[model samples]
Target: MCSHYEPVITKKQLATHFKVADLEDGLKPELWPGYIGPFIRKHEYADVGDDAVPFRELMVGSFGMIPHWSKDTKIARMTYNARSETVAEKPSFRDAWRLNRHCIIPAQAIFEPDWSTGKAVPTRIVRTDGKPMGIAGIWTGWKNPANGEILRSFSMLTVNADDHEFMRNFHKPQDEKRMVVILQEEDYDGWLSATWQDSRQYLKQFPAELMQTQTEAWTTDLP
Candidate 1:
């Protein structure tokens, strides 16, 4: 499972990298080392109707998911990563996977587990070209009943780690499943296209050669 990860880039840096005109007002630019800061995303938009909307109004959501059907928000703790293989059929993810398939989680880098030695170790993975990476994601809005508070949350899609060398080590030797769906720039338009079929076609594995990994220091705090 991808219960822990990183998106250390600042909002300002992400704006310049993705060329977006503005970042949400409350967002900070400091690098996030752990769960303390918001996840910074680039090159993706919030799905609204027939077009993709800019990220100006959307706040950085916690990576875990809080489904609309839940009675309380605690379910989000286990919904952080949705399996792409069963997304179309799973009870918690099917509806959103079909109609609410939206957004992209941008990150300067992500950490995945490597348990080949019987204990888990975190490996920092990044684009081989040093560019930021985009992970396929889905978002939803939850309303607080008592206070009328609205919260937008998201989760990253995961698939079998067939071609990614760095990702292979993260999955169970028998399971071979991995979180973090990196998208290619060439396929960005298709992945975020209004048509679902067009987006599905672009959900294949990103080029393995474009990714590189190295063991990095681990911390429980976000910068």
Candidate 2:
């Protein structure tokens, strides 16, 4: 599961890369400065509607998921990734999978592990061509009953790891599958379309050669 990710790029860089010329017009620009984190925030994306109508709502979202019907907040802490195989049936993700799907999780790289030696070893998986990788995602809004706080969050969708050499060792023994569904630039329209069936049909694996992998430094310091 993709429980860990890193968005090391600056907000300015991300805006340019995503072809979003009007950051202030669409989202709160002031929020961008403090959004850098181990987990990317939802304030970073441009909400282009199904018709590709650009809206001013913040598009970036937390990696974990918060079901629309959830009664508590702790569930989100454990729902960072959703398996594509069972997403349509899972209670926590089914509604969002069928309705409120989203896009644009701007990321340079993600961390995964190989536990072959009985000791987990970390590896940084990045785009082989040095381009940013965008993972297909789903989002939802949850209102906290205690304080009436509304939290918008999302989860990355994972599929079977095929020939992606870089991701071959990321999964645990119980689940050999390891990969995030990556939509190509041309397929972006199909993915974000309002037609749920069309969107699901367009979801496909990115080329394995598109990724580059390397061992990451082990650190105990908090970010």
Candidate 3:
């Protein structure tokens, strides 16, 4: 599960990359579950039909899956990471997937645990080429009937990484290996435009050779 990540780029830079209009400033440099982060989705317009306008827009959304029917925000923590194999069928993600509510999560690095040293050790992973990565995700919009407030949240999709030499090195030994689906530059627009059936084809592991990892040991002594 990709619970933590760093967004090294500014919203202005992201807006430029995605060719979108101006963005909301003050985006966080790092984010965790329940924290707001940048996400890209099709612009919503009342009069626009499916093909009327194809402008992609950026928004600041919280990380987690708050199903529209959810009564409260309690379920978000558990829905932060949705398994790719079952995403299309899972109750929490099914509706969004069926509606093509796909999104892209930009991140410079992700934190995970390394167990190669016989203990759970913290490590940060990044692209070897130093380019930012766009993780495949699905988002949901939940409304609070009491005050008519809406909460837009998302979940990162993960695929089996047991066979991935580098990715398999993280997480607990007993837990099944998994990794977030990072899309290539050429597939960005296609991923968002793809239907549920076509989207399934992008849920694959990124090449381990193009990734790099740095580990830091935990110390018992306090400063």
Candidate number with greatest TM-score: 3
Q: Highest lDDT: give the candidate number.
A: 3
In what order do the candidates fall by TM-score, top score first?
3, 1, 2
Global CA lDDT of candidate 1, please?
A: 0.61
Model 2 clash pairs are 42-60, 42-61, 45-60
Q: Could you estimate the TM-score for every candidate?
A: 0.78, 0.77, 0.88
Relative to the true structure, candidate 3 reaches a TM of 0.88
Q: Alpha-carbon error at 64 in model 1, in Å?
A: 1.6
Alpha carbon deviation, residue 30, candidate 2 (Å): 20
lDDT of 2 by residue, 1-223 (tens): 5655665346575655554333332332111112322222223244533545443233444457778788876676677678878888888888887774655565677777777887767667788777776677777778888899887777778877755565766667666767888667565545555455656665567787787785667543323
CA lDDT of every candidate: 0.61, 0.62, 0.81
lDDT of 2 at 84: 77
lDDT of 3 by residue, 1-223 (tens): 7887876457555765565555677876677777777787767661266665656767777788989888887787788899988987889899999999999888888878788788966678999987888899999898988899888999999999999989998999998999999999788888888888788888899999989985544322211
lDDT of 1 at 163: 57
Q: Runs in model 3 with CA error above 4 Å?
A: 45-54, 215-223
lDDT of 3: 0.81
For every model shown, the clashing-pair count is: 4, 3, 0
Higher-lDDT candidate among 2 and 3? 3
